[model samples]
Target: DSNNDLNDSEQEMVDIEYMGNNNDTDSLGEYDDTEVNVAGNESDDNDKLSETFDSLDEEQLLFDNGDNDTDDDEFMDDWTTDVIQSDCEIVCEQNMILVVLKKCRGLISMIKRSTILTLYFDAQRKRFKKALNLCYDVKSRWNSTYCMVNSFIVLREIIENLFSNKHQLHITQQQVKKLTNFELTSADWHVLLVLFSILKPFYLVTTAMSGRQYPSIGLAYYLLARLRNFLQQHNKKESLLEKRLKQLLLKKFLNYFDDENEQMELIMLHAYFDPAGFAALTEIERRSVEQTIKKSVADQASHSSISVANTLSITTTTANSENKPNANRNVKRNAMNLFNEFVGDIQYGENRENESKRAAIINEFYQYRKYVIEFNEKHEPDAGSVIVFWRTYGETFSILKGIAKKMLSTPATSVPSESCFSTSSALARKERARLSGEHPCSSVFLKDKIKL
Candidate 1:
């Protein structure tokens, strides 16, 4: 009905133009006054009608004319240019998109939001659906996948809001079906795999924790079995064999080895013989092993050395025992010589005001001198006794000496495990240049890599 009305309106405008040209206004003006006046009114009405029709024509011209071949070309050119310009803008602003992605990376919820926004902007409805489905799959496996799931829902809502009123622009189910069937590119698949890799350790941790008894050794065995199965499925025979050897070595150490208490030795053995098998140890166990090793070293050093004292002694020989006076005089002279030498080397003091402190110092020196004298007296007959003492007590003395040597050689005390944790933290935040102070669920995914 509207089409017919439009056609009739167009036809009426054409007829009015034809009649105006045929009936000259000048000739009509020269006729009788009554006739002239009526013709003048008709001309005025025609002029007003012509203006209205011109306006109508302008409005109709806004819609592309299907019948005109030339107009079709122009319409297509405009549409193509608009599309190309829009696509170019999208391409040009790709760096901005990357920046946004990086900025939103810290928080899991933010990452999810940004991903949805990117999908919406790209108009990838099918890809969006597939992403949502992936999130659902993850959630089905574990409810913690809610972050990704909520992101997908938010994206869907955004799409609906943007196109709800524009029926022609709406994303259809057919388009979504087509997109859902689209195969992921190799790079996309790799990214998904990396994400899965990140999640797997967390899954293992949760699974282990959920059990009635903490079966750490069993969990390790189960993990090893799973890895073997995966390797076999992938036809990785060499890797599977290597892993199997490591597991066997681990079983031998855990089941048959007697050094359970020597945790550092055990850790060293694991590092040397069964690198993969040591994953069975819990966090607490690992820490305990490290502390035990340090303490053992300290205790061994403490127990190894004997405390000894330094002393000096003197002896005198007398000649002519029958000549009592001369012999006595010679003995007295020898004793005097020894006393003078001893008094010159040793100093004893007393302070009336701080008598206790002075006495303590004197007593310590006296005890040391007495031990030295006794030791010298006992060994005076044997020249080889010094060598014998050194050889016999060498190990004990070396152990004592090692205490100071070790203290000096060791670097400033710092937890290497804690340093590793800080490094891991830095790696996690590299995608996010600034801290939002929000915790990420993906942090759990990094636990395996951060074991002490």
Candidate 2:
């Protein structure tokens, strides 16, 4: 009775969900096989269906009347497509205007100039729920170039769809031929992904070095080593191009930084003060850095005339006590105890001997190295920790701390200065050209130092 009571429209109408996958694309607008059961005191027969069909007219059974259920779905699909394409067209026009407002060239300029192609690509993004625009590479920034290449990789699918639906997007035959050459194939994607992977470390290192909030000297030295390690490691399945790239990059880096004693001394000095950087050094490198530091200490100590060993030692002449207890017949001391006291007196005499400046500096360096090793082992260190470590150990290693203070304060990049220039340019525009120098300085201090 449940099935028998159902009308023709109720039995025929079924909901269709567009999954937007390759498999469902073939059956874009088709009905599903729906089943209904008859469970009444009625005949379990074709007689019920036959009677119901005979009574129903073509007007009600065809489902093309005003009460059609598919109407809403079909209308929604049409309106969505139209509205999105319309919005895409507007976005494309605005981006094209930017291309005109600023000077642009190369592949980006070509893509932006092709209004039809941009419109189609934008439509694919909206349809796929990706709300991003294509980025343009700037001349002065490698990061921007990296971003441009990366964006294309992310939107590769949308670009492929646009090329696939050339006729649907009203692309002319001539444009299609031109676009076929620009289309990314499997080989192209492989090449781009490899190139992007190769550049990823450089981007990260550049970003890290350019930050102004923390010390970058130690970070620069450490990251440089990590980068070298990265380049040295090889994948078993590398292509010829990847091999060639690795070779080229390694050679380029080695040309400037490899095996040069003087250059390494400066870099190692910075790394020495940093706990993690010191840990990263090979034994041979650590020994070399220590030897260099010892020479500096010897020179600085030679001029001061203060004996470091004297300052460290507590000298005492072993004077025999006249108030020593007289040996009693009742309390005879053991011979082993008498021998130990004799040995202690000999060590006391040795402790009174003065140390040479050279020997004292060596002993100081060893103590510093021991502290560095223990401290590094106890706590994991980063760039910001280097300054704090030096500050905390200032009294312990006064000379080395002074050297580190002078050296590590130097920034690896001029980004801070460049940022100041940009901010100044923004602040002293035509409208505020009459401001005094102190006003700008105060404003910058307030902006950087004050939260409110």
Candidate 1 — worst ten consecutive residues by lDDT sum?
13-22
TM-score of each: 0.20, 0.56
Q: How far off is residue 402 in model 2, in Å? A: 0.6
Q: Pick the candidate with the highest lDDT.
A: 2
RMSD of each: 30.5, 23.2
Off by over 4 Å in 2: 1-107, 138-142, 237-240, 259-261, 301-360, 378-381, 420-452
TM-score of 1: 0.20
lDDT of 2 by residue, 6-121 (tens): 33323332122221245433332221111112233334323433443444343133222323432322212223331223344343333432343232122333344343444444
The per-model lDDT (C-alpha) reads 0.34, 0.57
Q: In candidate 2, which residue pairs clash?
A: 1-40
Residue 170 alpha-carbon offset, candidate 1, angstroms: 5.3
Which digits, one per residue and each the tens of the lDDT, describe model 1 over residues 1-452? 55456434432211101122213332333222211122235564335434434444332332223123222111111233312233433332334323332222212221122212222333332323222321212212422332332333345443343333222222234323322333233343333333334345545545553433331222233343344344334334334333443343344344433335563343332221111222434546544543544455444433432111121122112234444665465454578788887775332321232344334434533443344345545554222332343344434432322332332222111333455578889976784664545545443466577768
